[model samples]
Target: MLTMIVADDEPFIRKSLIHVFNWQEEFGIEIIGEASDGQEAYELCMERQPDILFTDIMMPMMGGLEVAEKLKAGNCRARIIIISGAQDFSYAQSALKMNAEGYILKPVKLPELREVFHEAVTRLRQEKDHQLNFEQLRKQVQSNMPLLREKFLQNWLAGLYRDEGELWDKIGYFQLPFKRGDVLTAGVLQLDDYQSAIDKFSEEYRQLLYFSIQNMITECLEKPPGGISFVASENEFIVIFCPDQAAAPGTGAISSLCEEIIGSIKKYLRLDASIGIGRACSSASELEDSYKEALAALVHTFYTGHGSILYIKDIQPGTAALQSTFFYKFQARLMNELKAGHTQQVLELLEKLFDRLAAPKLQIDYVQSICAEIIFTSARALYELDEDIEQVLEDRLTIMDTLYRQKNISGLKTCMLSLFYNLSTHVAGKNTSKNSKTINRIRAIVQEGYARELSIARIAEEVFLTPNYISLIFKKETGETLTDYITKIRIGKAKELLHTTDLKIMEISERVGYENPHYFSTVFKKNVGVHPLKYRSGK
Candidate 1:
């Protein structure tokens, strides 16, 4: 059962909440405690150690935001959610900095409460699972050599199965050869024109493309003579072929078989895929080398363009020189951007620059250098800030570099964005830069007007700036015009209300910054190409 604590200043409000929720019947939630103010809530939370905390923004002794900040500073495990009657989202934004789990406004509906409760429980479950996984893997590393243990832990965290016994069990039925004269051949499949495909993709379509790729990989290895594993989290597949040897004719036979597999994969998957083969290494213990070579072969996917089978020998190394301070220097630049609250610019620059590494002719060692540079940059930034991500990034990129060795454009995109998201979060948490504080204050005012009365004059007055100057600065920093962005935000809110609530059209209009229902309808149709009613109906 999950334990919950609810905090509010008003007795009537507290009573209403206790009545609204059936702690025992509706959910497996137990009302462990209640408090009349933020200070009391904090005390109760420390004493009771509830799984979730529902806190109001305003209180007499301390505000909920302060309580949340204190809890996060102490590394409290309880998930927090802010409840407030005010439409001023700046408080909620502050709560977000403290890692508050969710924000809900006044006039809280029962369904909304339930949704928040569900989210809190889900987060709790995730944290528990992660802790358990970490503990299990941590114990396994203690007895091994320090360097090997570090490498093994890093691999496991990157979704690579480090337990040879566990990995072999999965392929036990296939019974791959354990002896010498057997061969090992791996194929690298790259999504050839994924950039073009992504340009035409919606979020749902992009997910479909990934799932399709996963299915295609699975299809290719179903009954192969080798033992294959698709580590999708790492975006790479591994096939350990065991048959004949180099002293024999196994390498040639295995290469030919890989070509045949490529043809069959093309006939089916249909999304412009290509394959590359790594040189066959001597022993299973040398799987890492063969894996690297196989991935190096995938780099051919970019040059061969779309759907060509590239053997490892076809491409050669382009350069021997490496940038001495690539990772640390680049992260220094990125950290500066993020610290300045230039999140959008930071995102754009990382994406743009990292894509330059997607070349057709890089050798295995050069490819490793490219991946090392990016991972090193990320790791250096996190480590300098005292984060606990030592070796995690290096291991993940080690796997990702293999998947992208062929310069698989689509695969490269997946890896970069994932890295960027991680990079942004790390910076945001440690940002000591005070520069964006005032701008964020102003931006908060702008965000609150979507479903209510607002104007440049009103917002500027609150921020103590003239309307024209405010608009100019906002555009200079955020890249969107004030009026245009307000319209966009209001329309987005209107759509959300239309889908999530039973509020009538006029009410929805009034809620999202429009005084006149007719004007709201007009803008809705103009922006969404449909009347509000039609949108709600579709949902």
Candidate 2:
């Protein structure tokens, strides 16, 4: 309800104004206070902060004009009406200059008073609505602030802000705790096995867990002056620290904070985290370099194992000292072993190559480049052996994408080994000239019936061999079992249909020879490294 106050020197005038109308019934206003002078009315207005004030233009000690001037100076938002006599006309004009709402002369007219009251009520309602709208908009922007900050930081670290002046401007606007000359250090924290952690909780609880992790990191990092944390991605966070000028460079405080974050997350969230810290950089424009160093150090978690902190300074020397010739020799040897079908030897060489690549100082981009070289080299070798490398790898883009997404060294190793073994097996098939006729006939029948119901027994019937004998010969000739070959063919067809057609999964499953769509989905995920729907969505 709207609240009001009244002030006048005469008691009869005050009583008459109070009873001037049934205010509560006509205007829904509650007369909260009454005073005998303008001084008393100003005090009541300050104390009550009423929505409206009614006062006489001329009064003892303090007049209505003085009250209006004082309230306007104090930034009071109340609507004001001045009551005056003919001699107080000049004072009433002065009150209007102070933004008073209306002027009611002595011997007030009831209709005029009612009309002024209605207008005041309408203005008050509109003001209240505007305030409510502004409050709601403020709350929404506050809630989305973190996401917006993350986007800004992502763009900043990507070197999108090329001009130093513009970068500093944005830094100030975002309230980052760095100036032009301050040295900045970057650190990245990534949850190990983040997907597995999400899988352990219900869908509804996943975001809660992420929030808890973010809060824990914030609590640890924000305790130090000039330290701030931002979400870099869903499972990754970036912490930036600018040590005080009085402190020495590479102070231990940042390292201690990182350790605290690791311990807190493990203690509270029961999750492991890997932290990679970059060397100190002397300017805001160079923060992107520091961020890249931190990420490079973080990716070493794949080699060092999780739940540990790595610093770029400690690992930078090893990467700098690495010889290019060593990598070249390793690649040559890996190709030879793959061509010879020496699986054990190839695995050993791969492990050593990964160990070398996993040096904490090595950047993720360099690692990806080396891995890509190995993939292309292997693909070329398999192509030279008359195998359709595209068919063997399924899709080159999909394979490389999966390789790049590997979170740890082990994941990368597993993906590379899978590709290498598949290529090796295909290359081995070229050496089976002695049994070409038998293998060719079995292959033809299997290829022809891949979309229909066919099995080992049926294939053996067509080949005039026992089911067991057919399986053995197929394995010897193709380096994969008959069942494995058939499954690969069916999955390849399913992938094609998924990419090219809008057919539902069940229809695709039936078309690919699987009667149960659920089983087809399971098998598809096993081979593609993602669920059918997710793969189709390109996630």
Candidate 3:
């Protein structure tokens, strides 16, 4: 319902205006208040914020034009209709300049008053609808804001956006906390043994558990100067901290915040987490560097163990000297242990290797590189044992995947030990009769025809064996699938070409039996840590 206020200095004029029409019945507007002077009318407008105001041009204390000017200056949204005489018609024109709705001259005609009031009502209804629509749109955008921000941040960090102007425009549109030059520190919080922690719960409860952990982190970070935290991946949460200028916290304070988050998660969620805080960068554009630093620090959790805070500043530089000699010796010993089918010896060697790599002097990348070397060495040993490395590790819970997932040295040790145990058992059970000959034949076929579209059935036809029997015996003796062995051979060939030849990546892909260069690059990156070009560049 529309509400209105009436004002004029003449008491009879005011009374007559009110009595001239049954406002509610004729115009669907109610006279909420009556004022004898413009001053009273302005005060009523200020108090009630009515939809419409009807006032005279000439009045004592304050005139209708002054009221209109004051309301306009104050940015009042009310519709104003002027009541004026011939002499006051010019004043009414001034009110119209102030955006008054309409003018009803002295001896106000009822029909003109009703018509003006109807127009005001129509406008008000239109504005109400527009406002409602605007509000709904605002709410919808707000609801999807988190997802949108995550996508933006993910792309921004991936270097997908290069335009600074567009970046700032998005930042403002999203109302992100930090401005262009504000310093931001990237921090990552990873739930220790995330899969094991939430495995027992249903999907709904698992989400609840994640939400609880998020809330705990938010609460801890928001203590005076807060930061923005979002789930960067399934097991990791990314936090961007732009310290409050008035109460800028030190690195120690950030450490304390991480400690608080850890403690809170333990208390509330009964879960352990490791937080890695990156060194501060001067702007959002440099967030990717900070994010990489934070991730590097987080990787240290495998060495340092979970339930601890790691700052990038505390990580030491790795020596290439140690990686060359020490890691090589370690890998050789580990491979020897695995080849001998000594499960306990292999486990013990893994422990020692981890302990050596866990030294505070080693860089996170150095540690990761050592771990990758261990995996490659194990793969080579399995190959030597006539074992299929791919089938053994094809559970998707590969050493590299575990290296990313495991939270501590113990977790890493468990995963490696499990793989070694499986390898030992498979080796111990290998038959040296027809199965070995069949597996050798399969491996030969893969080694020779890896660059072709080789399938188990095709190889079976060439070897005069059933596809099913070939598959069974091959897995039993080799510990890997035929497809995986072929991939390993093709990837090895691709790598050799990448390093030894000047062939374009497309030619290399064709040579490796991959028709698509993009697919070839993806497989190359998954198997080898870098893209084909980067690997070729020796990065």
lDDT per model vs. reference: 0.65, 0.80, 0.77
Residue 489 C-alpha lDDT in model 3: 90
Worst 10 residues of 3 by lDDT: 244-253
Candidate 1 lDDT tens digits, 251-271: 554555455555655676555
On residues 264-345, what C-alpha lDDT tens digit does candidate 3 reach at each position?
Answer: 8888888889987777876567678878888888877667776978778777755533556776777776665555455677
Q: Which regions of candidate 3 fall more than 4 Å away from where they truly are?
A: 7-22, 32-50, 70-78, 87-89, 105-117, 131-183, 222-234, 240-251, 267-270, 284-288, 316-539
Candidate 2 lDDT over 1-539, as tens digits, reads: 88999898999999999998889998889999999988898888988999899888888878888888888888887788888886545666686688888887767888888888898788888898999999999898778877777787888888788788998898887777777877788888988878876787886687787778888888886676448887877877888887732133245777677778899989988889988888787767777898899887876776677887888776644344347799788877776666655667777898888777666446665677678878887788757655565677756688678877777777887888787777767655644563578789888887789989988999989877667656755776679999999999999999999999999999999999999999999999998889888888993
lDDT of 1: 0.65
lDDT of residue 397 for candidate 3: 48
Stretches of candidate 1 off by over 4 Å are 1-181, 202-208, 222-224, 233-235, 244-257, 319-539
Candidate whose TM-score is highest: 3
Q: Model 2 reaches what TM-score against the true structure?
A: 0.58
Q: Which ten residues in a row have the lowest lDDT in candidate 1?
A: 242-251
Report residue 15 deviation for candidate 1 (angstroms): 63
